[model samples]
Target: MNSNNDVIRKLHELTEADMSEAEFLQSVENNMIPMQQFFTYYRCAIMEIETKFRVLNEQFSLNGESNPIEFIQSRIKSYGSIFRKIMTNHIPRNVEAIERDINDIAGIRVVCSFVQDIYRLADCFLRQDDITLIEKKDYINNPKPNGYRSLHLIVAVPIFLENEKRLVKAEVQLRTIAMDFWASLEHKLRYKKDLPPYQLNLLADDLKKCADQSAEWDRRMQDIKNILESN
Candidate 1:
């Protein structure tokens, strides 16, 4: 029985037409157990990655000079058509060893002081031999036509437990405080259309300029904090 009510209903109907009552019940139990495990394992993996990022971020903060970071990892709900495709088609095929192999299983966002630091910290994070670099996009250096800027990387890592070793992939984002603020605001009001394209383009250009200015301010702020700490 799939945890999903709809799937269980459909499975019951399908089995009613073909299998004996006891056999159908046994099949449901067997199949649902592994399916449930697939989700549970991925959730555990995401939590582990989040905890690692938290430890790293706290270590960086101890210097009182590094910008903050946040991490989030979550399971995509099994209600949408996307999940339908994933479960019925993808999972059935066992095309990938894990369901997280398809979705955004793990995510981390690092907020740095300056544009330069974004790349610096990203390089530092990727330097871990345990992490296998899969893909990268330096959006900060090469902003999208929409003037969005950030660094994106996908990394594959091998997680070992007492019982087994599993390969997990995580997406990491790096951006400055200004860039993150702008992105957050944009996301909040994404449905607005009153702003003309030309105005939006001009706004993006202005925000890019602001991002640069904020980077300078961040450096100055860090310097001021350091000087005070020394005193």
Candidate 2:
């Protein structure tokens, strides 16, 4: 496939061919240039944000840690299916739109010791003139029906590449350590089955209640830590 249209046609042909989904997906992976561009685009997008905001890996990590591009490659390796679906099926609004969605499509969990850090970073990330906030979801304040709590933002950013430029959409998630733990567990359990609407509703209610309690606990622990540090 020379362009996006060719890519689509190739996808259709692959689907029709006498190969399993795994084989079809492997063929797509074998396309060296596009695959390389795909990951490179995502990395550059994140780097742009980091550069714009003066945010280092150390700033986001609780341990003040940093990771190399190889670490990022390892992480994306697990998300191969997500990339495949995007390339073959989800025809983006435009080339720029595709970049924005790809750049903003991933999630970064900011694990803070206190609840306030979540709000603080969200404010900092959203206030940037370069980063356009399309939507804000305060799940920590009004969480999902599941006991999930995280600050979510849908943001649009314009990326100027050498050959072309485009606006991309990204999803940002901010939450506390406790809330993050709950969310990770909740995602694992919920995706285990095809739950009915009523069951989903029940799970959501339980999650909300749990998130509320977790936030309360975070506040209390933060207060105690601050008091000890002060003394």
Candidate 3:
């Protein structure tokens, strides 16, 4: 079997799964290079946002205030995921359409120390002149049906290429460590394709319970933090 990076490389080299070697090579020549360039902006955007978060961290440290941000994770969506989304959305299956329609080619997940930190960091992050807030979804205030909790932001960041500056939209998910922990597990469970119906139902219920417990923990931690800050 091929390694993970090897598998991804193959898919990029071969745009559609149905293509043979000759077609794959031609498609690669036609589509892959431009797609690669587009993703470069995503990489730059991730770096730009990551740097902004690091600046926040540094400022908090100098103030002797506990940092709101615990850590950050960023990724460019896999070619397969992008392709599938294109097909599912009934949009043109080309790099241009994907670039024009897909807002989450890049993703950033910010894990914070407390629930309040999620809000505080998001507010500060958007205050920067370079970050244009496109959309905001407060899942913590209105948890998902399965008890998922997070603050989702769709922000456009400017990326400068050789001769042009372009704005790219990236999805940012801000949540407490507890919420992140729960989400990671929930994702794994939900994607377990082999799970039987009864087993999946039980797992779903259990995951919801775990989410509630994690949320309560976040609340208690925030309260303790408020007490300490008050003293």
Candidate 4:
């Protein structure tokens, strides 16, 4: 279930005299259905991973331990976004190049209650024999230049097709609730193109402060949880 309303609206905005609006709309409608269907595998991969996390949460609950994971989110990149990425990166416009060059086409975000939980679930997830760890970037341990903090993992998981199994890559971002807050705000600010450089730098510095404070809070909260559990 995808909406072509956005595509149709965008195309109308860019309408030119030479192009037939009726023909162009029909062409877009024709093209969008297949593109939407092509990403079905990615969605399946997301569902598989989401299910794994949910199962893990339930197990922890059964054991009388706290469930670290708060919620999960998944997304498959839109065709327009993929096209822009290909153009920006100069990647060949083909299925092979798209898979080879774009690892974040399919993404999942896991928000946890504590910093320790982030590492704990990630370790457990990657330790599974079926999930192949392709790459990892620990921004939580080493914050990004813009003061963004999250653990990013690129893993290849097998998607069982009707004919065969296809391994697809999905980028997972694991972060604490505090980190998610800062990141959400940072992302909102980042897309505000009209902001002047000085203001942007100030915002970046402020975000750094917030990130540090959040990290400290994570440490103290985890310590408190540890103390309470020891009783």
As a whole number from 0 to 100, the lDDT of residue 93 in candidate 2 is: 30
- Each model's lDDT comes to 0.60, 0.59, 0.81, 0.79
lDDT of 3 by residue, 1-231 (tens): 888755554545334344443432343323544555767889999998889888998898899988888889999876656654654576665566677788888999989898887888888999999899989999998999999999999999998888998898899999988999899988766655566779989988898899999999989988999999899
Model 4's alpha-carbon lDDT is: 0.79
Candidate 4 is scored at a TM of 0.83
Ranking by lDDT: 3, 4, 1, 2
Estimate, for each residue in 3-29, the C-alpha lDDT of model 4 and write its tens digit: 674444343334222344344234332
- Top lDDT model: 3
- State the weakest 10-residue window (summed lDDT) of model 4: 24-33
On a 0 to 1 TM-score scale, where does candidate 1 land against the true structure? 0.58
* Residue pairs clashing, model 4: none
| Winner by TM-score | 3
Q: What is the lDDT of residue 104 in candidate 1?
A: 46
- Clash count list over all predictions: 1, 9, 0, 0
Worst 10-residue lDDT window, candidate 3: 21-30
- Model 2 lDDT per residue over 149-214, tens place: 778777776678899875555566666778877877776665434677799888777877877788
Candidate 3 has an lDDT of 0.81
- Preferred candidate (lDDT higher): 3 or 4: 3
